[model samples]
Target: MINQDFLSRIRRKNNWTQEDMAKIIGVSRPTFIALEKGIGSPTLDQIKKLADKLGCESQDILSEDIVDEEKYREVLLETIRYGAATDGKITKTKLAKLIYLNDFAWYYQHLESMTGAKYRRLKLGPVPNIYFSKVEELINEGVLNLEIKKDGSQMISLSRAGQMLKPNLLKTEEKKLIKNISQKWQGKRTEEIVKFTHEQLPYKICRDGEVIPYELITQQDPEYVY
Candidate 1:
């Protein structure tokens, strides 16, 4: 059930009325009431918007599992390190799918995502909404670089390999999974991985642009995963 009290408290704390809450959530007043009364469940997108407005992680409103952003950044760096080509660059789209596979496949096994970040279905595949902005942030920090190719694809690479944090934030298990995913997808064409993720149950059942529920992966067959 959605935490009705949290919504009410946050709304009140901000001196906002029910109408204001509805506006922020992009829903009508009655629908907002239904959500508040536990008669309806909030969509992941709505939860994400509310969390953004309040300057908090989406899990803060939905669950106790907070998103570990630093660890997520580390995972991205490690994915690039393990999965990049000999020149140490990975296509932006491919990198997104690789991280999605790592996170969702881990969730399939452990009942939790590696980053606790929410992913939304997009034309290419399931990707966290923040993936682009986060990549941009890394580029700004001189931790990663981006190049636009003649084919219109964006390629990313580490600006300085040594700039990656020491005593990595990723746990052993997490790093292992990323390495395994990297090896398996190595040399695979971008089209092949795109087809693979597009066929997964979580992506298949969701509408275009919908947030994919992590629970759906539980129903996916083992071999079909990642």
Candidate 2:
């Protein structure tokens, strides 16, 4: 239970299935599945072995504060709310870039990312692997609607603008940063924002499918940061 989110996230990151994790952790498949679902947990020895195989400390796997899922969910919805076009929809590609900009830009200033999500460089730009699953989860929960346009671009929008919730995990400073970045790109074409992100130092230097390190963003000029 302590690292339920971590177990889920790390397993996904490695492209491992429950059976694979079960074997890696020396547990039965059903037990690992229960651990993933937060129904139970692995023994300390199992956790230690799994941590060793993953080449990380037990604390790294057990630490709940490493990433904030609540903050991530709130940020995703808030980014959708702020960056959507006047028609109240944002192209999925552009939405992802905007969120990446917000995260890295915040890290540039505070030396810590807003949500602590790991972002990798992809064809669209820099984005977290979790972004896609989180958006899909939201859509499944009826909080978001995904529409495919005639051009084949996926558009994301809130089920209702009035459904916005107060963010307990996000700060005023964080909200302001999201708003400012969203404002800068709101009227621009998705191509423009995608190009801007692609041109950023973080994106330019990182190889395809590689995680863009936050430290690299610190080396960028202030003008190109966003």
Best by TM-score: 2
Tens-digit per-residue lDDT, 16-66, candidate 1: 889999999999999888776667677889989998997888887675423
Q: Spell out the clash pairs found in candidate 1.
A: none
lDDT of 2 by residue, 64-97 (tens): 2345666788998888888888989999999999
Model 2 scores worst on lDDT over the 10 consecutive residues at: 1-10
lDDT of 1 at 100: 93
Clashing pairs in 2: none
Error of 2 at 200 (Å): 0.9
Per-candidate Cα lDDT values, in order, are 0.81, 0.83
